[model samples]
Target chain A: MDMRRLVGRNFARIRREQGLTQEQVEERSGLSQQYLSGLERGQRNPTVVTLFEVAQALGVTPVDLIQPDNVKMPRKS
Target chain B: MDMRRLVGRNFARIRREQGLTQEQVEERSGLSQQYLSGLERGQRNPTVVTLFEVAQALGVTPVDLIQPDNVKMPRKS
Candidate 1:
């Protein structure tokens, strides 16, 4: 279902929006940076709790992660 | 991430709370039953749009899908 792409698309954006690094999210979210990297690359499928953890660490809800945010600044490619 | 188990753990519960079946969710959510089955079984990782579709079909937000519901009815195994 292109789950990786879907999740990856928002992973980094949210991290950045919160001014976080992979390590920071990993530390706060209890998710490994490698896992966060994989999720950012659309290569991982996190569990429900992991989803909640990351969202919570980002100071948002899980819905905030899936739904498009109005912070329209483009990513630095 | 134990994604399959995590996703599967809640997939059916949510569908039941909404009183839907694999087929009904398939049609209404624009997802195939097979895919829905995989999702329910934690064998598939749906895209963001797919996640949105299922959440919309359930008349709940994506947060509703992942967050633990107050509904305490257990599954009939």
Candidate 2:
């Protein structure tokens, strides 16, 4: 499913919606701007911890960054 | 939130629901059972790629592994 691209796409979309820039997210997430750039570009793969940190920085959940763009899949717990 | 524990909980639940064991997942996901055990025990921090691999092995999406156990948060994309 190309999760790297999916996460990058969602991250860019959500950051824009929140009116946040990469620099702002870098500050909030305690992740380097370079790394954030790589992530947004789908050039870097992040750990679950990194995903959680970025989500918190963006004021969202980890799932928010990884969900499919088309449909909301059903989940149990 | 503690994402490691969340992923672990979700992983175990979904694996059991699918009637698959660690061995089966190892075969399907190409992840070592030792690593999967640590992941299920909340002792390992996995990358997004690993999460996606495990999700695929379980017949679920990456979001399913990281979603909160309580509420199904609303998503835009």
Candidate 3:
């Protein structure tokens, strides 16, 4: 599997589902919008800490960011 | 949560459960045993691709390596 693409797709989907913009996520994650954009494009390979920070900012677990499309993660309300 | 430690613990536990050593995992994952040791000690922060490679080498999904302690993953045969 293309893990980077999978992560990017999941991240984009979750962010959109939560009605958040990349700029908003950038502010929350303390990551640059450019970086977020690159990540969404699967152009950035983020470390575990970066992944955790992004997941935290998105109000989700790191697992949620990398889950395969076939597995449905229960959303937090 | 300390994502590094959590990942390390999970990795170590899963590796042990599978009866494999760091050297063996290093051989399979193409990651050095030194690196794997550091990772297992929560001293290394790996990229998502590295995580995927390690998980694949272990014959498990990336989710399995990062699963929270409270979430019991069904073992694959």
Q: Largest DockQ belongs to which candidate?
A: 3
Please provide, for model 1 over A1-77, each residue's C-alpha lDDT reduced to its tens digit, 9 standing for 90 to 100.
Answer: 35456557777888898899899988898888888899888787665556667788888766566654444878899
Pull out the clashing pairs in model 2: none
Each model's lDDT: 0.71, 0.91, 0.91
Ranking, TM-score, top scorer first = 3, 2, 1
Candidate topping lDDT: 2
lDDT at position A34, candidate 3:
96
- List, residue by residue over A1-77, the lDDT tens digit for candidate 2: 77788889999999999999999999998999999888999887888999989999999988889888988678879
lDDT of 2 by residue, B9-74 (tens): 999999999999999999999999999999999988898999989999999988889888877669
Measured against the true structure, the TM-scores of the candidates, in listed sequence, are 0.53, 0.89, 0.90
Query: Could you list the CA RMSD of all candidates, in the order they appear?
Result: 8.2, 6.1, 4.2
- Report residue B71 deviation for candidate 3 (angstroms): 4.0
lDDT of 3 by residue, B1-77 (tens): 88899889989999998999999999999999999999999888888899999998888888887888876779999
Q: Least lDDT summed over 10 consecutive residues: which range in candidate 1 chain B? A: B62-71
Supply the DockQ value of model 3: 0.80
**Residue A22 error, candidate 1, Å:** 0.7
Could you tell me the lDDT of residue B47 within candidate 2? 88
Residue A14 lDDT (model 2):
98
DockQ score of each predicted structure, in the order shown:
0.15, 0.69, 0.80
